[model samples]
Target: MTNSTRSGKRDRLAGAAVRVLHEQGVEKTTLADIARAADVPVGNVYYYFKTKDQLIEAAIAAHGHHLESVIATLERLPTPQERLKALVHSWVEQRDLAAKYGCPTGTLASELDKRDDGLDRAIAKVMGELLGWMERQFAAMGREDARELAVALMAAYQGISLLTNTFRDPALMEMEGHRLERWIDSLA
Candidate 1:
């Protein structure tokens, strides 16, 4: 097969891994399941990912990249504060999506030390980039404690998101988001 075909097959497997992880949770998903879902042979799946952890790493990386793209597009709005609010609002609107699929990074991070070292590092790298981006934006707005504030805000956002997902209640999400927004505004 051509390189393009091979690459497409690999991507399809990775996407399937994401779906499996979302549907079955990381614990229940297996290489055979992913192969079946991708319609690829199990050995072929192994060709792309030496281990199940590698596949999970790819899925998490894909999710992180998708998130970064979404945030990057929204971050280009008028002012730093506007961009920040828009970021938070955009994330809140997508709470339903996470409710359906689970938070990929949070799922991995919660099991952080249990994950393969490489996978853990990759997830941490993505998170550091995101938090660092938030810090830079906040600092530009004259918030000297931007790093601490960014960490706090993201912690609140993630924590609230997990809570809302657990309860399956939009009201909880809205309450948490509104409180976070007010706190951010006070900081500004």
Candidate 2:
């Protein structure tokens, strides 16, 4: 296969793994499930990943890349405050999926935290990247307590995501998104 073809298959596997992991959680999602989801042969999964842990790592990396894309998109807005609000709105736009499967990154982190294998650290790094982006936005807005505000913002998102998933209610996420936007606007 050409390098582009190989890379495409790898990306397909990683994307399928993310979806399977989100839908079934890490414990229940198998490599075969991912392979089937990717429409690749079961053995082909081993071509890209030696173990389920490696695949999970790939999924986490994909989420990190996704977070970076989100940050890049937000950077296009004219003002820091608009960027922050846009960030919240972007997440809120995932309310339906959040209601169905919970926040993708948050749910993966929570599930991986249950294990003793230290995958939680990887999750923390991914979460930190998002928090750092939010912090920079707040700092650009002249907030002295940018880190604290960022933490609060993420806390609110995680909290609402948990509630939205538990209740299977998308409106809760929308409501919280509006509330967060207002809170962010109130920030200095």
Candidate 3:
């Protein structure tokens, strides 16, 4: 295949892999399934990603980085308080984005965690980075135990997302967001 054709194929497969992972979860997704979803040959997926784990890891990284970028944009706000509010709003919005792609990184990480320690460790690092980012923002506002606060915030988010997924209720998700907003507002 021409280089251009190869690149296009790789992009298609990667995009399809993301879709498949989001729909089927990491445990159920397969290389052949990804190829079928992408409308490409099975060999093509292998060409781009050596293993399913590689594809999932890449997908999670891609999704996680996209989220981080969105959060980073909120940092331009004047005060850490505003930034934190923006963070909360951005998170709710981002989870909606994840709904389009299926479950977010949190779900993917939870599923794959049992099967692969390496991938689990990698996911943990990504989560740590995200939490660390939040910690810095809280610390800027003179909040103590910013890291612990970040972890609490993460727990709140993960719990809300999981519950929302289970119930398929947008209102519940909104309530969760508001509850978290209030909690953070209290902190501020």
Candidate 4:
């Protein structure tokens, strides 16, 4: 295969791994599962990722890229407050999936934390980037306790996500999203 085709396959494999990891959790997901999801031959998965850890790392990178894309989309808004609200709204939009599978990053991080595979720090870095972005938004809004506010806001979402997933209730996320929007407005 040409280099371009090889790269395309690798990307597809990474994307598929991300989806499978999100759906099945790291311990339960396998290389064959990711290959099937990517529609590549099972053995071909080894061509791109030598081991499961490599595939998991690729999935984490894919999630980071996805997060950056979402941040770029939010950046198009007029103000930091509006951008923050848009972020909350985007989570509401994923209520159903959240209820079914939990927050993608949160769930993955929680599962990875149980293992001694050294993936915890890498996953934490990805989550930290998100918290840092949220903190910057609050700082832009002139909040004296920007970091605290950011932690509170993120904690609220994480709490709601856990409850929503546990109860199988998307409405909980929707309610929390509205509450978060109002809270953001209150900050301004």
The candidate 2 region of ten consecutive residues with least summed lDDT is 179-188
Could you arrange the candidates by lDDT from highest to lowest? 4, 2, 1, 3
Evaluate model 2: give its lDDT: 0.94
TM-score of each: 0.86, 0.98, 0.84, 0.98
Residues 1-188 of candidate 2 have per-residue lDDT tens digits of 99999999999999999999999999999999999999999998899899999999999989988888988888999999999999899989999999999999999999999999888899889999999988998999999999999999999999999999999999999999999999988885
Model 3 regions more than 4 Å off: 1-11, 94-103
Per-residue error for 50 in candidate 3, Å, reads: 2.1
RMSD of each: 2.2, 0.8, 2.7, 0.8
lDDT of 3 at 37: 91
What tens digits encode model 1's per-residue C-alpha lDDT throughout 1-188? Answer: 89999999888888888778776777888999999999999988877899988898778777787778977796778777777777787767867766665455666666654755666677778778878888987897899899998999788878876877787775666777778778777877
Q: List where candidate 1 sits over 4 angstroms from the true fold.
A: 39-43, 116-118
Per-residue lDDT of candidate 3, residues 1-188 (tens digit): 89999878877777777678878888788899999998998876778889887787777676666767867787778987787777777667755644444246687778777884578777777777778888998899798888899889888887777776776665556777778888888987
Candidate 3 overall lDDT versus native? 0.76
lDDT values for all models: 0.78, 0.94, 0.76, 0.94
Extract clashing residue pairs from model 3: none
Q: What is the lDDT of residue 158 in candidate 1?
A: 81
How far does residue 43 in candidate 1 sit from its true spot (Å)?
4.2
Which pairs of residues have clashing backbones in candidate 1? none
Residue 134 shift from truth in candidate 4, angstroms: 0.6
Better of 1 and 2 by TM-score: 2
**For candidate 4, lDDT tens digit of each residue in 1-188?**
99999999999999998889989999999999999999999999889999999999998999899999999998899899999999999999999999999999899999999999999889899989999999999999999899999999889998999999999999999999999999999999
